[model samples]
Every structure is written in structure tokens, then in C-alpha cells.
Target: MPSADCDTDHRFVKSKVRLSVKVAPKKRGSCTRKLQVDKLHELSEEFRRELEVRLDNNEIPDQDEDPENEWQHLKTILQETTGEVNGFSSRKNKDWFDENDAEVEDLLKTKRSCHAKLLTYPNVQAAKAAYRTACSTLQHKLREIKNNWWLALAERIQSYADMGNTRAFYEALQSVYGPVNQVQAPLRSSDGSGLLTDKYSTPFWVAGLSTMGTFLVTIGTYKSPPSKTYPNRK
Candidate 1:
């Protein structure tokens, strides 16, 4: 019995004897592992909540708050908190992003249909084509968030011809043409030619300078011949 007790003590001493070892962590590997673990933990609670909701909705304890909405609210709070702590709340960057977003939205809202009224003029087709090209380019730029489009459009429309291509042309023309033709026919014609009533003046100018020139030629030919001769005498 004494030999058996000694053997038992020897076995206990052998089992209880511990080795003291100090293993240094590999700095890069340990950092990567810790980061991965932290990211997993960061998202794990939300994932767990979602899983619980999906697996057993009735089992989840509710505190008078909708779970999905609450989760979204939590996510927003987390983002705001992270942004603050990480110094992501840069005022200049935030303002720039907001301005860019608003500019893109404004460009998106500028539809081609808004130009329909301006399309009624004779010279507008080419201008409208150019405008359509510009608008298409602008839309593409907006979607990609390229910032130079405002400058590009300024250069495109700087031409006087382009100005005439816009609704401003109609407005300027309308001011000259409207009162003259919109009224009931006046008792006397301005030139006393009787060739043009005020009603005809509207059509002449609205059809542009070519139509007005044609009207002048017709009226002049009816009145008198031009006092000029050709060199060939044909």
C-alpha cells in the first residue's frame, strides 16, 4: 500500500509539472489577425440580430421598436460615431460632396422636353442638335461626377448663333413681332404699299430674314423695277 501511494504521488507530480514558455507574437501577422477579428466583431452583432430575426422572429424580445428599422438606426449611429472618431467629418470634403451631389441632381432634372417651345423656330434644328449633343455629354459627365461640364457649356453657348438658338431668340423676336401683328388690323398700312397687311408681317418675320427678303422683292417688283444694269447686258 505504501508503494502504491508513492506511485500515485509520482503520477500526480508528473501530470501537474508545467513548462513556462514565452512565444513572441509576429507583429504583422498578429496585427492582421486582430484587425480581421475586430471587423468580424463589428459586424457580428448586426448579423446575429438579422439571423435571429430570420430564424425565429417570435423568439426575439422586442422593446416596442421595429427590429429592422432599429438595426438601420444603429448602423447610422455607428457610421456617424465612426466618422467622428476617425476624423472623417472633414468640413471641406463634406461640403464638396454635397455640392457635387446637388449639381448632378440639377443637371439630371434638365430634360430635353424643356426646350420644346424653343424648337418652333427655323434655325433651331441645328442649334437643338448641338444642345442635345451637349446635354447628352452633360448627362454622361454628371453620372460619372466629372466637374468640368459647367465650364464646357459656357464655352458652347457663348456664340451669338447659339444665343439665337435658345428661347431668348424667340423672346426678342416676339417683342418685335407680337404687338405689330397681334392687334386687329390697323386702318392704314405703315408703308402704304397695300402689298403687306400687318397679318402678313407676322408670317414674313417669323419665317426669318429670307421670307422678309422675298416679301420685299415681290412688293418692290409689283411697285417698280430696280434702276441697275448688268455688265454683260443680257
Candidate 2:
């Protein structure tokens, strides 16, 4: 494990043993660096102070000498300062289906064993065959479990809605959708026209028409030639 404040680079390891059950370590390969960006507002002062100090200490390489090296130096400083101040973020893994946990754990162990055997005995046809079979079985089981989980979740959400449990419904909705990152649907008018437009992929946030109310209008009202007077002229 990395520092307590930072687990972005480390994969979670679940180590539990029970009789007639198998446990396999989770792979650390998928680990990614996800900075605690949400904490920037709270920790910006510390980060900026330290970063400024490093810059003032003549640590930055001269741009005239080497632009690439200067950029790398600045990038390293910013990354280090951010990590020290805000650390990293790690998402909690939720169990997709608790009822089939034991079976899933066993399959995980078998798959891991097959993979290890394939790696150790690359030239052995039996090892490759076993690995492929294990992969297929594990994938099929996981898909089934996830499908069942989705059905159960939908029913649970519906029940919440039916029971008039607004708080629970909101929480369930949030859990399902997570955070919304997409920009809000916008309203705008075409560049040449002032009429309000609601269309696909409008970039502007909001717009209004120059005219909104109904009004009577008459066009091409008869105006006789200047030499010939009109009968309706007063």
C-alpha cells in the first residue's frame, strides 16, 4: 500500500480466507493516478505557496537552453506540489452481487491460477487451453451476475418511487447516474435570425426572441401612382 492519504497508484487487495473457499489478489496493473481535484479549493494555498518557492529557487531550466527540459521541470514541480497538498482519490469498489460472492471469489482464484500457469509454461498447449477456458467461464458468470443485479436494482428503485420515499429515490437516482458532467442543454438563435431556437447541440445558454406577442399586419397597401390619386385617399 502507498501512503494513507494516497491510493491512486495502488490497487485494492482483498485478502480473506475461508474453508473450501479460494482467494486471489486483485491485479495492480489497472491502477491510475487520479488526483484529488475536488480538494483544490481547500488546499490551493499550500500547493501554490510550495510551488512558488520551488520556482523562486531557480529550479526551472532555462527556456533558451532547452524548452522541453524547462517544461518537464515545471510539470514535475506542479505534480509534486499537488500530490503533497491534496494527495489522491480512490473509488470504493461496491460488490455487484453479494449472494454470489463466494462463487465469484472461487472463479477469480481459478482464473488467476490459469493465467499464472500460462505465463509459467508458455510452450505448453495445455496451459494455453486451460487459460482460455477459464477466461470464458469467468466472463459468462460475471455477465449473468451483473444482469441479475441490474434487474434487482430497477425493482428496488421502483419500489422506492411507489412508496413515496423521496429521499431514498433521490439517493438511488444519484447512485445510478453518479455525477453529471455533460453541459446543460442550451437554447440559442441562428447567427442571422433573432428567433429563439431550441435545437440539437445549441452552444449558447439562453436566448429570447425580439418579438413574442401577436400583432396585425398589412402588406403592399395600394398606393396609386403620384399622378393618379387613389379613391380611398382622404
Candidate 1: give the clashing pairs.
none
Q: Model 1, 114-232: lDDT tens per residue?
A: 24323444266765675566577666776565445444434554553465677644444443344343566544334554424668766545656677789998988895667997688
- Cα-based lDDT for every prediction: 0.50, 0.72
Q: In candidate 2, list every pair of residues with a backbone clash.
A: none
Runs of candidate 2 exceeding 4 Å displacement = 1-106, 180-234
TM-score to native of every candidate shown: 0.18, 0.36
Candidate 1: Cα lDDT at 214: 94
Model 1 / residue 62 / CA error / Å: 28
Error of 1 at 162 (Å): 49
Residue 1 of model 1, lDDT score: 12
Q: What lDDT tens digits, residue by residue, belong to model 2 across residues 60-149?
A: 534557878878878888887788889887652344756688989998889878777766787999998998898899889999999988
